[model samples]
Target: MTVQPYVPEPLPPAGIDWEAHIPRIASANRALARYDGILQAIPNPRLLLSPLLTQEAVLSSRIEGTQASLEDVLRFEANPKEPIGDAALADIREIINYREALNTAVEALKTRRLDLALVCDLHRVLLSGSRGMDREPGCVRTIQNFIGRDAQIEHAIYIPPAPEDLSGALGDWEAYLQGGELDVLVQLSVLKAQFELIHPFCDGNGRIGRMLVPLILYDKGLIGSPMFYISAYLERNRPVYYERLLAVSRDGDWNGWIAFFLHAIEEQAGANGRKATAILDLYDEMKQTVPEVTRSQYAVAALDALFKTPIFSSAEFFEQAAIPRRAAERILQQLREHGIIAVLAEGGGRRAATYAFPRLLAITEGDRL
Candidate 1:
């Protein structure tokens, strides 16, 4: 028997049995709101959230088969001039691009609507200088594409709607994103799966679709900040994530899909909240202890820079930490002696050495990395 290509039904599900999943929906919303409440209280979200965002970029890219760990990324970033294998450098660049794309999208959402234009811009950023660059970085596909292990479309595991149907499908998707009667969480669950099925961009569609999760929730005012980290959950349950998505198209199981998605948001929200709270508490402890440890008037400035970067070169630190060269050198020397920062790699003769904040990296990377 010949296997036919999968074609997704249109958006704004005509008759979903949402009533059955009301309790689950409410629970997920409450969990998300609690996380948002925690995020709302953080005075400087970007500074505190930077590590989590980087972790997110790593996990999300991992789902797409990128092997760069959080440490690899931070280490590479800390010493970009160092010689690294071409493969590792490429993987690290993709991870960095993911973070850059996410930050750009979050900023753009502040002024403009979350429409196709913003999505394209994010795709462009994601593929720049990476392997996906030649696949039409910021544009929708103009030819047929498929998802599978084989190169031939005939053996594809799944095939999205034809290129001609994409415009109408995307227009409908954009309309739903604008406003909808359904609960935002429920609506978001549908939108993510739909976006994957649509596969808007020829390359980086999976990554861009995942990025839409936090962006949609934040833009819809469901979350205080766009710091949700559901990719951790999806990456852990990779098999089930794909299974549920395929079930939606195969069996029209919106209820099952939404339930699974809601669970991801609920569990990951609680986890993200706990991690953020821990990071914030660590920040406070450092704020008090760093000055005591360094015994310098510029300790607070150095502490702030460490919290923001966590992994940095000593030269970059002196310049960006905004402290006098001598003072900065003294502070760094003291920190090294006390083991607050460990030398990852040493540079000789006017070149700065790279250091890592062990506790901070442990918190961000967790046990997995």
Candidate 2:
């Protein structure tokens, strides 16, 4: 027997039993608000949250079968000419593009509306110079697409909307995004599910859908920064992640999906808050220690760069950290001597020596890296 393609019904599923989810909704909102407070208190939220951003990129891309990690991306950026394999190099580029795309989208939301144009533009940035470039990065699909083992739609596990139907569905999605009065968290949960069901673009739908979580939150003023790390939760609960999404289409289980999303939000928000707090504390300590240890006026800048790219090359640190070359060298030496940064390689002739901040990496990776 052949399986039929799954086409989701339009938005605002009737009779959701919203009252049934009141507790989860309230908990998610409280967790998010607490996280937002922490974000507001950070001196420079972007700079401090930089490593967390990279971790987010890594986990998000991981969901799409990309093998790159935060370390891989920083190391690749540190020395693109290194002897890494082509496959690993491509994966690193994809991860870097994820960061670039997300950063671009967040910056755009500062002055622009969150609509299809912004989403498409973000998709363009995501696939540019990566493996998915040929899949029509910013363009909505003009052909049917499916997710599963078989190329034939009949054997596929899940099939998105027919290409011809995307315009109407996406239009309704964009409108609902702009006109929802439901609690923003619940609204965002539905929006993510709907976007995934539509699978707007030919490629990068999963990644772009995940990216929208933070984008929508920031756009709606629920979070001061778009630094929410949600993929970690989804990746941890991988089976249920796909199951809930499938249930939404197969069983019209919007209530169950929204509940799962709320639980993810609540749990990930708490974890993100703890990680952010720890990162900020480490940054504050380093701010004072690095300057004193290096005895260079540029120590603060160097420290900031290290926090941003904890695993990087000495040369890249010198050039991109916005510190004088000589001062950067001195800071690097001082950091190494004080056990703040560990040298991964001692550059001999032409190779740029690599470095890593163990404490910072540990904070972000949390014993996993």
Candidate 3:
């Protein structure tokens, strides 16, 4: 009985094989377009649902190994310090970081064009104060790093660029950006996938890769808003996502990977649409009911705040809803009575508990978009 020695294959020079991945790309884009249609059909204020939806998408990636349910995430929002069953305060903080990063990336996209510099900024937000720093945000790796879970190490699956390769690869990337030859959406999707394959940072590759999709879309003007998200679809189909990524690298399975990606776009777009429609409806219902329940201007203001962020605290509600502290507190009670938002456990010593729009919360946490 003899053991065979392991042999490493030559690495494919960094690039995508679009010709081979065309069918997959077509199918995936079809899926994405279908959902985009759904999103476009929905009405306003409801469009605000995109952020909450994006938050769920980000959390899905962050808590990848935890197996924590959606309820756990929403619960963490109110009681981040005491989320149920194994998720720690640190996890809650990570979730909040993810939300902030998504917001940062999306807002930047909406406001202006994206640059490699912005990529660095997004990584800065993502890995902020984490152990992974000490290196600059987009600083390419000088050596290989292993990705894996716990002692097993198999999950360790990213490779940042060698420090020397960083500038050249980014140079090529910027050149492509300026060439303006590729379709913008196609360019964004391909560029993101390529970025992941390049894996230029020692940490934050996944989040940064995901962030790039929307950023590029915004940069290209395909979307004025950051409504599209891939984290949920990728996290949900983790095995397939990884397989496609690797397949494109080893087997020239770009078509398959692109199709899968486009499918993610399609499916996620539809899910976002449904959530958006539901969110808008929820807003109208709340507005109609609020006046009857409480005639205060605070009610109107709280409704406005919900569009910015669907959850709130007495302090936040008081600050944004523009009512006396006591009046703001009472309005929340009325809101609860009207089933607008349900209270969650309090933390951070705010005296008043935090609350979430549980139905909206449910849609955010639900399976399938």
Candidate 4:
């Protein structure tokens, strides 16, 4: 028997037992508030939290089967000319595009609301020059699509809305996004699930859906910026994440999914808070260490550049640190001697050497050296 495409109902689905979820809603809100406070306290969060963004991109793409790691992406970025095989290169490019797309969306949200147009633009950047570029980037699907084991629709585990009904369903989704809801977080949960079920684009739907999490929170004023990283939690609980989403369409279990999502927000917010705090602390420590190790007046500048790009080439560092070339070289030598920065590859002839800030990278990876 063939399964019909899942036609999602309009947003603000009725009959949700909101009262039963009061405790979870409160806890999630408190956790998010604490995280946001930390975000505001950090100086130049964009530079300090940069690694977390890359990790978010890596994990989000990994959920869609991308095989690149945070280190792989950074190393390849530091030296794109290195031959890392076609498959790995392709995966790294996708991961890079994820970060680029997310950054684009964050900037676009400053002047515009989170709507379909912005979302489509994000989709365009996400699949540009990657494997999914040929899947009609930045456009809604014109054909039926389904989630299943293989390409066969008969085996489809979850079929999204048919092509003809997509516009109406999406219009409702966008309107609901603009309208106010009692609980912004719950609204986010519904919006995310609804978009996935709608499956607007032929490719990059899952990624775009996940990208909207931080964007929505920022737009709703839940966070200072669109830097919250929830993918770490979602990726760890991959099976349950999908199960909760499927349960909504399979058994009309919105409450179940909402509960799961709220818990995700609560738990991930705490984890994100801890990571941000650690990164900030490391930044403070490096402030004194870089000066002590290199004994250079440009210590603060050098430290900031390293935090911005944990894995970078000698040339990149020279340019980013923006100090005299002689001072940069001496500082690099001192840093290497003191084990502050590990040389990933030695400089050869005219080729620049690559280096890694293991201590900072370790914090982002949830490990400490």
Which of the numbered candidates is closest to the native, going by highest TM-score? 4
Runs in model 1 with CA error above 4 Å? 367-369
Better of 1 and 4 by TM-score: 4
lDDT of 4 by residue, 1-369 (tens): 777787788789887788998999999999999999999999999999999999999999999998999999999888888878889988998999999999998889889888999999999999999999999999999998889999999899998888999999999999999999999999999999999989999999999999999999999999988988878888999999999999888887999999999999999999999999999999989888889998889999899999999999998899999989999999999999999999999989878999999988888988322
lDDT (tens digit, per residue) of candidate 3 on 1-369: 211211112222235565765665566556555655555655552345654654664455553443434445545553434425444544544555556776787677656567777777777776675445565655666755544444333444433345566667776776665457434545655666667766777766776787677666556655545566667767778888888876655565555665677667767766765766666677677778777787886676767766555565556666766778888777788878878777775635545577777766666656553
**Candidate 1 lDDT over residue span 178-259, tens digit each:** 8785688889999999999888888888889889999998898888687788889999999999999888877788788889
Instruction: Note the Cα lDDT for every prediction shown.
Output: 0.87, 0.88, 0.62, 0.92
Per-residue error at 82 for model 4, in Å?
0.6
lDDT of 1 at 79: 75
TM-scores of the models, in the order given: 0.97, 0.97, 0.79, 0.98
Report clash pairs, candidate 2.
none
- Give the per-residue Cα lDDT of candidate 1 at 25: 88
Candidate 4: 10-residue stretch with minimal lDDT:
360-369
The predictions' CA RMSDs to the true structure, in order, are 1.5, 1.5, 4.8, 1.3
Per-residue lDDT of 367 in model 4? 30
